[model samples]
Target chain A: MSKHRLLAMFKGFDDSLPVLRDIKAGGCAGVSIDDVDYLSPIEHPDIDEILERKVNVQKFTFTGAVFGVTFGFFFLASAQASFLVQPQGGKAVVPFPTNFVLMYEMLIFFGIWTTVFSFLFLAGLLRKRGTLYSEKLTVDQCGIMLEVDEHKLKSVKEYFKKQKSIEIREEAVT
Target chain B: MEIKDKIIDENLGWQRINEDVIRSMDAPGKYYWITFAVCIAMVLCAVAAEIYQYRMGMGTVGLNNPHMWDMYIATFVFWIGMSHAGTLLSAILHIIHAQWRKPIYRFAEAMTTFSLMTAGFFPMIHLGRVWNLYWVLPYVSDRGIWPNFRSPLVWDAFAISTYLSASALFLVIGMIPDMAILRDHAKGWRRKAYGILALGWRGDDRQWRVFRKTYMLMACFLIPLAVSVHSIVSSDFAMSIMPGWHVTTFPPYFVAGALYSGCAAIMTLFIILRYFFRMEEYMTLNIMEKTCKLTFAIAMVWSYLNIIEFASTWYGHNTYDKELLINKANGPYAHIFWLMLFCGSVAPFALAFQKLRRHMPTMFAVSLILQLGMFVERWMIVAPTLSMAHNPHQWDVLYGSIIEWAIVFGSFGWFSLLFLVFVKLFPSVSMYEVKELTFHLKHEMEEEKEAAATSSKSKAGAVGKPGLEGA
Candidate 1:
């Protein structure tokens, strides 16, 4: 089946939101919007509704932190316990208070690494580049890319037109 | 015009901000090369000094038995303390949603990362056999020898490394969106460099949502981590059984002093960047004024702690503590002590006046003085306490060698060099956050105007009614 993708650009968030909503409603009428993605120079409040889609990045962060704490404790304790304990000044081999410091540091270190890993995973960063990208999206312009049926192309273009899209481009997907 | 409206006018739009920031990276002027060359030269000099010290041993650098922790450790503390204000300011201000932080937080966070890098060097240099530095790492080895987790030095390693990693991550993550922006605008090798660094950021809502969440998580982690890192550094001295070093108030005292010095360093760099980058509109007087005010407040906190330290020492009636406190004021290092007081405590008072805060040259001079005072303050904290320890027989007055001074100067050049490279590469001012602030201000102004228009129309309608006008 052939697909039509419509890309619209706007000057700012305020200019873009109404157009985005109109396109969503218009897609519901006929084209059945397959996917919608926004590209902008900066984050916007209007983007929140789209971003609220469930993401599991924070779960990995929590798991990494817990592992960090447990591993930090075990590493510090085992190193001290297994070593040739000189028993300095009658101090315990694996002191708790001092070891807590290392534990705290490890928690943060592992937590941060895991967070970055999760970010990479969930955000699909460092992946094979996608074709639908515009350099202007990084500057003053905001872009909305929509996937729809080829048969509904005329109506979708008219829908974006009614919303007064600053610019539009249509591409055919195989 | 209202202050907010004026700020909007000065900053303009996303396009203008991008142009202003990216222009700095476009070409290397003669001044840029000159500054870069000077930093390289300073770094080379420091490398030579380190080589000399390595060859001759620890004795070559004014480190006697009593003053073993002289300039290197002092400078380490200073840098560590200097690292504090950036993360503290950036994280805390961000958490609180301070709009002014939008313009300065990028460099401030960069300062935290680079200063920590410089700080990491001192412990390595202070080691007798720097090659054996890996022994500090916690791992099971064939020899079964492990680092004592209980040692504050080990804690120092952990704290500094953790702080460095987190700050560096924070700095890099913060730069990603900006890097994506650079990737779009750049050409040739620069474009490839930014593209790789940007990690295919398309500024999609999903990527941004995750990025913001991760950034916020890091900020939350950074604040407590930053505070704890310095507190751990303080424990390096305070955990010692030494008289002056064993104060109960050391943690808060050290934290306050770190913030004080760090804020001063920020002001010093803020003005320099503003002047050099021609970021007058973004790095406006309003931000500097707020910075000065914060510095003054921190100075006051540090001073109050300083007084409490003295008072507690005197009142506790421990001969060694009292003697050390007295010696700090009037003994061998008296000049250094008083200089610290003058610079750290007294000079910040000038900032309390709005006029001084607004004047760039005066504020810069004051910041420099405050940093100098802070540098001396670190030295004072270490040297005097160790020199005038309980054993008078071991007491000796020692000065930092020329080699030590060279290394100290080198650290400054190293930090500046990194920062200069950063400015040349990335947007030193956060392009997106600044644009966000401008947008909010513009929106607010429109709202206010609309409200005024509606209110005025209602007033006009009321005035048209005879009973209302008479009443």
Candidate 2:
């Protein structure tokens, strides 16, 4: 046997907490807190308390924005100067106002795309179809997916059962 | 107390919200078919008109030298202005955390992207040579020439593409959660379709966290981007030395006008969606009143800005500006100008009446009037200025020919076509957000009841005992 993958589903927000705390407290032998994942229909800020690292998407957003502004300005300056060899209506070769407008748009344009892609990546979306799930999870139920060793599967299942989980699913890999 | 009614039906459970919203995506009714068929016919007519115009050149649509920026540009601005409805309800109201917007924002966001798709066509249509349109792009060419980025036309190209891209992204990204809900519930080919669009969303705590952040960040970007876009559109006229078009207040005026038209459009769609989908629980009368209030406020802002533009023209004493202003009031466009002023400025006062706001049919008529007013305002902006420009020799009065009018109506058809297809394919109301709103309002209502019960108990005890330590 390789490892036991299990999901515990609960009907209420607070109902998921005790099991989450059990894994976080290291009370569950052969189970790692890092392997536990939470599934919810809505945002639960309390879920962040158990995770070691908070999701940091704004960094990716800012980096993309900075890059967009830098690239946008330079491209406008260089492109206008190198090509428009003739005088432009006796005005500056590259005007700042128009260029600035495009640059600001680029900042948002780049920032939005980067945030979306990074969210897709960090959230582990578009991964191989998840093995353990319930239709109820996306509706009223909350799901917690975790990996456990075969030796500890029975005990963890019992622990989840004691909390009166609405449902429990498992995929054991050999 | 009726005014304080919950925005969505708090009595609804999570599963009910899902079922109701998903049911809206089921087979549409007879009215939908009739309207959709009309839209398809309009689009077909427009396509024929465009083909004729393309073959005969822009002149066939009645474009003389003076009326070059005719109905196409004004309709382009109209569609662009209509796109702002989604931004107003989705982006601006999102940042403010207006829960009432939850049920309606999806359709508004869809309108934003689809109207943009429609608006993008006008510039291409207005081009004398539509095939040679890529020359406006800043790409490297065989001739070693580049587009003049200094032109406000160029600014428009950039602003529109960016606005379109971001808004489209915003619309799709916001739909992911709801798509996942549909994905779980749908079957057969529908499942596969929604599954692909759902992007493997599991609605995990982490995904929701990142989704919320990304949604907010995008909303933050969209508001200013929307403002900047209309401002740039204003510059297409303002940058020109045209007497009536060069007002400094044009940007704010345009933005205000865009929001006013956008809000009115939202009301029209809101009533339609509510009636058709039986989404009365979500699109409640109280919420409609709130939307009416917001629209009334923006209409006032637009009216003030209109006055400011006129007052500036009167005081500045620019001979050309004053003469053009007088001509607009007394010239060929005078009827349209006064209609715009009356419809946009005066008619919205109906919203201030509670009975009128609560009456759906009255509000619907008012919304249509506001749209007509905004359309006239754009026509007045473009037509009168060009007709009475600095050089009188280039002056020509243009009432759009049949071809131009046909194309304008067709754009509306195209937008409706997209919107009709979207509602059929996707849930017009956001399911998860409505569930969340229900959750919040339920808790608040429960807390209020509990508070009321506790107060009554305390008062009863005090009446019997004359005093109590805790009381």
Candidate 3:
């Protein structure tokens, strides 16, 4: 009984083409690669790098500016809110100075919110399709594999005989 | 044969474990019974205190105007702060790839759940008429007025509920497989209990797929909840107009303090679990040391904020803010103020050194001290400022009466008592994650050596053994 069962673990990838090549070579046996898993780590070294690489630096800064502007708006609104009552103030009653504290907080809060969410989104956690591979990949091993015609089995086996930890098996349908 | 030569050694070769290390159920001879009786008695005491508080109204707990939320608020904040250590250690550490955090995380999460339960009681009980507490929420009201969305109290309610739900979900999702493992290993009632909790989890591919997805989603959800919960708590104070209470920095500052105190509380519990549950093998020096580093860093942040807030008050020339700062530092409560600095600042800062951090007993002591100091910090925030208000004529000295003190003591007693019972009920260390980490670490180490050896062997040989080499 022979059914293609192959496991490959690669260290680094220069491009998705090599991975795509490996997957094509495997021909749908059982392909698992941690390349996407390590993408965040491999791409951004730290928080600063995360901010820099995604071209979100300007966006993140702009959000901070917007946060300050909104805080000012809230400050004026709340202050002017009291002005609507009896004994209307002669001049503006907005607490601009005290409101700066709120502005600072909103900026930091939004900063952390953006950074944390972006990390999750970048990791492909936001829109995960059915995982690219199966559950056994987590525990046993990870690789790309091909389920080929019985006639091609011997050739495929021979091809990967040189690589480390390569195995092939097949089974006929009942 | 001569008598000396004929004599055989008959020593039992027993290892000496710290008395604190032994589980309450498994205490050495008489101490076992002693610890069990004590823990049971403490649990009983807490239940009795709760009953008394319920029957006589919360006034029995010495809560009154000006000091409306004294010991309970302090304790609630303390317990909630303590809960942070577990989730932070679990989810954040998981994201950051710290293998050592796994063993400590399971119990720490349990601590979080129980402490949250205990923390929850305060808000309910603090509402003197606990029966009417449901009105605190928004419902299709007969009064036609929804609970004020603007009120920080409502936000606190929403935040705490969300946090508890999320934490419970997080803890349950993480524990399901482990519970299944327990189901397999257990017998009778334990087996049935674990089996139910396991929810027919059989480690199948489909089950794993869902489990992994749910776990990832929960973690993503929890990270924000963790930040949001503390921020909401801070909002309760910041929303107020009291000089010391109103500040934008409270949210982040409170979160930092919560994390700082939470880390220390976790350390205390971690060290206790390590010793008491015979978990030194699983918990280990590496885990404690990593926690020590986090606690030290967070403590520095907390101290920096404390100074900055004081500096801002002094610099801004806000008369009320300046007076509150002065009263906090040098007025009637100066002793606790300095003690807070000593425990939260100086003691933990010593952990900056690697050697001191590695010393288990020292780390344990420092952690306990910092947790106590955090309790005092919450007290200093709530009590002294109210006692020394802007309207000097209305200022009154607030002292915690005996009943208030009892509730505080009884809550700690409740926490410890619950913790001890949990240790007896379940394995405190996460067996699966720990085993997985150990396997990964060993495999990684072996892979390094094998890579070196393979390079050398490749020149001399043609084939390599594959299956077990990597496994």
Candidate 4:
């Protein structure tokens, strides 16, 4: 039978671990197997069964590739226009040695353009809601969201009931 | 949290400059006025000389067939060399992660733009028929006069233009935020002037985003421009069949020499600005020491290149190249060449010691000497080669006439005058970046302080607080 809420008794031993374990074992089925919930000893081996996921956001890498492309295109275009048109002093049109100068210039120009622009774009800046990041996150905090349905709400609440120290609160992504 | 705040903190090393700038502007003492007057007067003299050159034609300058380049081309090279200061300070320093570069980047960029403008003048004036200067472009003509792309001269024109535009744009982009600050602080017509230049900047994230992106772009653009500009300049000499000018390594050698001299020039300016503007607090000994190290390192590279160049000349066993190289060390221009070696190499080598690098007076003196040595090097490069041209029968030794000397002197005056005027008009150090860096440094310090406090209060406080969550 599905249970609504289970209020297991806990004291000392930093209550969070047993509460977390209950949630993990309970499997959001709204049922608790043990009847008389009591405080577990600090050295209890059952706590080892609890699992946690590790996650982190990584900084975006700047490639400067687009910058290179823009530069290459510009230089190629400018080279085709200037040196590639008429052969100079009986030399072949688009003299490879000389046109390399234009290539050098374009690479510089485009590389810079890409590096700067990409940094801005990747930083999530200049958008409508830019600069609106939660200031509190700069200090100490962590937010872990657990999805719950109405059918399992009782079980989760009961599990959290044992974790009185955790300061659980309802939240929506809105 | 924000990069801007990170850059604006108190110990971030900009408080002294901020205070000194305020003092200089408000006080305007006797020496300030005197310096202003002298700068203005010199600027006027340069203007007069330009007008005179225009009226009297290129004949007024001492340009002959064999030594056609004369002072103008030498001055062009000199100014171009000077322009390297900005790119080295701003772009290269940024790339290499030199923090001291923050305060000096703007002025360095200004140096690039203005020196380029000055350098551009020489080519026009040297052409004599300044109006027909457009004929150098690749255009269809009845005479079928196409610019010789093989000629380094044409390449120089393109390289200089591209570099000048890129540099100017970079400078303007970097200055926008600071211009906004200036606008806020200014009154009357000055406010309006700054307002226009500020480009409606607010400290919004969008502007900052674009600004940062553009700045990074500029840095990326500038490094290659820096290398290419000097390489093309060297090409002007190398493409020639002249003995000393016909080396394959001239491109990189010239680039190194340009950067060495450029860094020294920037150091000299930094020293002058520090004392004159009472900016010692902002431009600290730390910055001086770091820049001196850079200067010293580049100096060493230059020394190595110098040896390599000479060694190649000897190894090649080309009679003409060998003779010219020996003559550089022991010929008619031997004294100046030796002096160049002593100042450019010997003086800077002493800076290898940490103590010597930190000594302000010694550092300044060395920088000045290096600049002087570089000038002599440029003169030696141009003059001695022409004097020892192929035809011994036509071996007319080149000497600077009074007119040539006047023009050279006038160009120096012009450059200084423009710099002085720029100092008066704009904030010599960037206020926005300084503020942003200062703010960030302070915020980080506060975070550290808070962390320490919390740690002491609770043994497990840090773990519970979730450091770097989703970082």
Candidate 3 deviant stretches above 4 angstroms: A1-174, B1-33, B46-62, B454-471
Q: For residues B308-406, what per-residue lDDT tens digits would candidate 1 score against the true structure?
A: 999999999999999899898999899999999999888999999988899999999999999999999999999887788988999988768899999
Score chain A of model 1 by TM-score against the reference chain A: 0.85
Q: What is the lDDT of residue B106 in candidate 2?
A: 91
On residues B199-285, what C-alpha lDDT tens digit does candidate 3 reach at each position? 654442223433444455456546766787787788777888888888767887888888988888788887876675566566667
Can you give the lDDT of residue B234 in candidate 2? 93
Determine which window of 10 residues in candidate 1 chain B has minimal summed lDDT.
B2-11
The alpha-carbon lDDT assigned to residue B60 of candidate 2 equals 89
TM-score of predicted structure 3, chain A: 0.43
Give the CAPRI class of candidate 3.
incorrect
Report how far off residue B371 is in candidate 4 (Å).
0.4
Residue B452 shift from truth in candidate 3, angstroms = 2.4
Q: Evaluated with lDDT, which candidate comes out highest?
A: 2
TM-score of 2: 0.96
Q: What share of the true interface contacts does each candidate keep?
A: 0.72, 0.71, 0.00, 0.14
Off by over 4 Å in 4: A1-90, A106-174, B1-29, B43-62, B138-144, B440-471
Q: Put down candidate 1 lDDT per residue, A1-174, tens digits, no spaces.
A: 688777878777888887666545654356433377777878776556633466677788899889999999988887887744475677787889988888998898899889988888788789884477777787778888778787878877777777667888877775
Give candidate 1's total backbone clashes: 0
